[model samples]
Target: MSLSQQQELRAILEKGLPHAAQPYLLIAQALNTTEAQVLAQIQLWQEDSLIKRFGLVVKHRKLGFKANAMVVWNIADEQVDDVAAQLSSCSEVSLCYRRPRRLPDWPYNLFCMIHGTDREIVTAQIDAMVKKFSLSYVEKDILFSFKAYKQQGARYTKQGI
Candidate 1:
């Protein structure tokens, strides 16, 4: 893709997802192009892996999900994939991803999020998950929402948020 096309897509994503009622058509109008063109570019970007994900960024606290926790698992390297797949299929596990362990201090690779109305609920869910999965080497850290920082897509432009 040319620099201009990349810039246009970046702008659209950074400015927030396009409007409903034919959002792609609206974006096409803004770019002075057809909806098909806009869609094609989006598809190409996704194919190239330039677009990681597109979805709502819900502020859990605002939505009454006051309890936030990160459950880290120290599964064997070979078991990581299976554990991740199982964790991802659970509704309580909002987000699940694998990361490299830091060192002797941090031995967990699989990370999952559990959000609920309170810490007790979140803890119970995590405990249930650990028992159900038979995860012996798992550690959980409850993250209280003191404040929420910025949450948005990457903005390649030099403009302000």
Candidate 2:
């Protein structure tokens, strides 16, 4: 794509695409381009590694998920991948990933987010996961969220790129 097309796409992305059945078609109309053109550009960007990922970000609290917990686990290094795959397969887990352990203070590396309508439900789900994964001996912690915050997509304009 040309520089101008890239800038226009970035501008549209900054404000986020509309939530509709044919959002891309609407975007194409606004950009004075065909849907196929818009989609092709997106695919090209992905193939060139310009765009890593694209997905919807939801406010769990607004959807009745009142209790949110960031569960951190210190799984054995050898089993980290296996355990992470298992955790990622769980329906209760909305997000799961691995990070480097900050030794001397924090040793947890695997992290996952579990959200529910109540604390009890969230706790039960965590308990179930622990049992199912045989994580009784694993060092883990659950940090509950007490406040809801507005979530927004990335803004390329603000990044001074």
Candidate 3:
């Protein structure tokens, strides 16, 4: 494949897939190529590890989810894996991950994001998770987002991404 065409395809995909019956055909037409070529190029990119994966970045605020809370927990190192797994399985948790805890000031090592239509809903969900997991005495904190930033996938090109 032409390097310029490959770069163009990458740049186009970074924006998002087109909403159409045959999105690949539309993209192929735009790039003056066949739909099969477009699909094959994407496959090649994936096989070569040029692209890790494709997924949607949901706009929770637009979907009526106004509150997003990142609850950080300081659980025992031995129990962290179990607690994180439990938290990750919860439907309310959008994201759950582990991070190194900073001593003296920051003690939270496990972090999970919970989103809801309102603060109360998110808070209630967090409370339920805490109780369900028996984490009442665990050191933790809830941080709510005050603003919604523009969210998008990775940009391969400097312009039009």
- Which has the greatest TM-score? 2
What stretches of model 2 exceed 4 Å from their correct place?
19-22, 29-32, 43-56, 155-161
What digit string (tens of lDDT, one per residue) describes model 1 on residues 33-107?
788988888898889998777788777787888787877777788989998998898899978999999889888
Better TM-score candidate (1, 2): 2
Candidate 2 accuracy as lDDT: 0.87
TM-score of each: 0.75, 0.79, 0.77
Off by more than 4 A, model 3: 1-8, 30-32, 41-55, 155-161
Q: Each candidate: what lDDT?
A: 0.78, 0.87, 0.88
Q: What is the lDDT of residue 137 in candidate 1?
A: 59
lDDT of 2 by residue, 1-161 (tens): 56776678777866777888998899888888888988999898899998788877787688998899999999999999999999999999988999999997999999999989999999999999999989999999999989766566666764323
Worst 10 residues of 1 by lDDT: 152-161
lDDT at position 94, candidate 2? 84
Say which prediction, candidate 1 or candidate 2, comes out ahead on lDDT.
2
Clashing pairs in 2: none
